[model samples]
Target: MRTLRFLLQKEFRQILRSRSLLISIILGPVIQLTLLPLAANFEVKKIAVAVVDHDHSTYSNKLIAKIYASKYFSGGTYHSSYEAANKMIEQNKADIILEIPQGFERNLVREGHEEVYVAVNAINGTKAGVGSGYLGAIVADFNQDVRLQWNQPGHFSEAPTIDVVNANWYNPFMSYFLFMVPGLIVSLLTGIGAFSASLNIVKEKEIGTIEQINVTPIKKHHFILGKLIPYWVLSMFVFTIGMLVSRFAYGIVPVGNIGLLYGFLSAYLITLLGAGLLISTYSDTQQQAVSLAFFFVLVFNMISGVFTSIDSMPDWGKALSYLSPMSHFAAVMRMVVLKGSTFHDIQPHFIAIIILGIVFNTWAVLNYRKTT
Candidate 1:
């Protein structure tokens, strides 16, 4: 225990002695927590819409008013025909085109029928889908109003009513920023800690200090714990800064218990640091250790569902995703931030990471040697 304490102290002093590295450890989390949330917004608004009012009647004007009144749409301009609207859309001026047929109101009142055309650009399928849904809803609402005015009290025999109640727990708004920011924080910390801690041990090996330590009476576990624990603490500091930025700067409140988050994050830190130690066990140069650690982290990020949904992936891909620490961390983060998940909700991922941490830490100790 005393040897472990001494080694931990030495590692802390070594980390603090490097001014540039300490600054990176402090500021890297800030940049990730701030920029990533601001950049990753999924909700769309102010979709430009063009109107081709062939009728040029009060009814056409009323329909245009309703379209513009909707929060999803913004009025681009009035066009004489579909050709003109198409020209505007071709030039990227409009996302939706509304064409009101000639004699629209007359047909509705006298013939009991009128038709309107809505053309939506489907180049960006997501935007088009959402915009089309909004336009369809507005048109349906207007048709209902017109029918009500025309003495069609129960048009569908029964009052065709649709009731939708959506409940979004944790992040009720489903803020994309809130969901993604924590994951970005995890990615940044993983990259930094893995590279830095691995480089520390590898640098000692390259310079012959590892031999000096080996010659001493320091137990293998004592040396390993001393080197790893300080970085683990440093990772915790980076994580705390990330949490503060989430709360104060980005308004990302974790709906789950803070203690639970911290606990899992601590486990995650050990997993990362242990992986770095394993890299050090294999490599003698700081550059080699950093490069190898980066390769693994990059591969982990790609497979981790950090930027994509894991549920959308194939079974083989999903099976492969569990190999990454980021995958488990991302899953746990979503549950904690979005579902307000308790320990029970995240037990599988938490247990997997714990098992992974133990396995890697064991591999690091077994493979690591005092000599070359």
Candidate 2:
């Protein structure tokens, strides 16, 4: 206990003395939590469109007007021919082109149907799909309006209609930031814990101080605990700050018990910091430790359901996500924060993280050599 206390003191002092480390610990979470949710939005908006209006009739003009008034579309370009509209697409000026044929309105009135051509730029597939979907919705609404205006009562009376009422649970407004901020907090904490812990032993190696401590009577577990504890405390501090940012900036308040969230965080940090120490044990220099830590953290974050849902992934990917501590952490975070999940609800994830902590820390301790 006495040896561990002194070692902890040394670790804290070392961390406090480094200006870059101090600034990163204090400011990185603030900046990331403040800005990332605002920037990393999934809602597609302001799609550029081009119109080739060969009909040039009242109904066609009205259809174009409806699209122009929509918030999803940027003001469109009008072209006389398909060639001209195609040129606009080639110049990267438009995402979609809507072509109305010559007899569009005439055919709709006489034959009660007309065909319209839509061309979308596939360069950005997501933008193209979403933009075209918005355009199709506008055209559908226009058709319904035309049918009502015509009021050919017996013509369409037998058609079936189904109305859908969408209710978004946990997030009623579907605020992307609400969903993203919790995951971002988990990701940031993981990076801070892993990077800081991984660099501790390697930094000593780079500065020739490690040889001095290695010669002492200190046990490997004591040294490892001393290194891990301080950063674990610091990571919790950062987590608190991130939660506060989520509350004030984005108006997010966890629907579940805040204490439960913290409880899981404590366990989750063990796994993360243990992984860092494992990396540190393998790396001989700060540069090597950082490279290895970055690689693992990036892979963990990518597979952790941070930006996308794991349920949507393939069988192999879903199976692999269980191996990532970040994956369990992210799931527990959303379950507790958004869904108000109880301890029983998160038991599986909690057990998974604890097991990971034990496995990783045991590996790190076993690999750490006092002589080398």
Candidate 3:
């Protein structure tokens, strides 16, 4: 314990004395946490639409008005022909085209049916799908309105209606920022704990400082713990900054127990730092360490259910994802923040990280050789 304390002091002093690195380490992530949530949003909006209206009828104009009025749509300029509207899609000026056929109102009023053509630009699949879906819903709502107005009380027979009352539990407004902020925080934290920590240790080796430590009478675990401790504390400080940004800048407040989130974070950081040290133990240079660290963290981020769902992945991918510490941390953050998950509810995640901590630290300790 005494030896670990002295080593930790050395590590902290080294980190603090470097003003440039210290600023970059602390300020860079703060900027990311503050700005990323604003741009990394998943909600698709302001989709450009084009309309081909051959009817020029009352209902057709009303439908066009409704499409343009929606929050999801913009710039639904009326065109002369379907071919002209299709040109807008090709030029990327419009994401989707709504073609209202001639005699549309007459067909709907007299025959009770008419087909309105919808053409979506599949170049950007997600935007196309969401924009088209939004248009389809508005058209359906318009159909319901027109049908009710045209039909008298005795002309229509009522059927059973199934209304879905969608209650968005944690995020009432379904703000994508609420869901994404926690995951982004975890991602930033992981990069700091893993990539930056590994780079730190390798930097010591590059400067011949690690050689001086290796010659001392310190226990292997003591040396490892010393390397891990300073960064561990700094990680918590960074985490506090991120949480503050999440709350004040983005209006994100975790609904779960803050203590529980901290407990999980403490466990997760230990394992991540250990993995970083394990990489540094084998790496000869800081470049090698940073490259390895970046590769691993990037892979973990891609597979960690941050931007996408894990359940949507294939069987092999899911199995591999479980091995990543990031997957568990991301899951824990979302579960606690969004669902208010309890300790018992997150047993599997907590245990997985602890187990990972043991494995990685043990590997690092064994790999770290002290030469006389």
Best by TM-score: 3
In the range 107-172, model 1's lDDT, one tens digit per residue, is: 988997888898998888778889989989898888877777776556556456787888986767
TM-score list, all predictions: 0.86, 0.96, 0.97
RMSD of each: 3.0, 1.5, 1.4
lDDT, candidate 3, 266-296, per-residue tens: 9999999999999998898998998999899
Q: What TM-score does model 2 achieve against the real structure?
A: 0.96
RMSD of 1: 3.0
lDDT of 2 by residue, 1-372 (tens): 999999999888988899999899979899988988888888888888899999989999999999989999986899999999999999999889999999999999999899899999999988998889998999999999998889777776747779788999999998888889999999999889899999988888889888998999999999999999999999999999999999999989999999999999999988899999999989999999999999999988888999888999898888889999999999999999899999999999999999999999999999999874
Cα shift from native, residue 252, model 2 (Å): 0.8
Cα shift from native, residue 73, model 1 (Å): 2.6
Worst 10 residues of 3 by lDDT: 152-161
Residue 221 Cα positional deviation in candidate 3, in Å, after optimal superposition? 0.9
Superposition TM-score, candidate 3 onto the true structure = 0.97
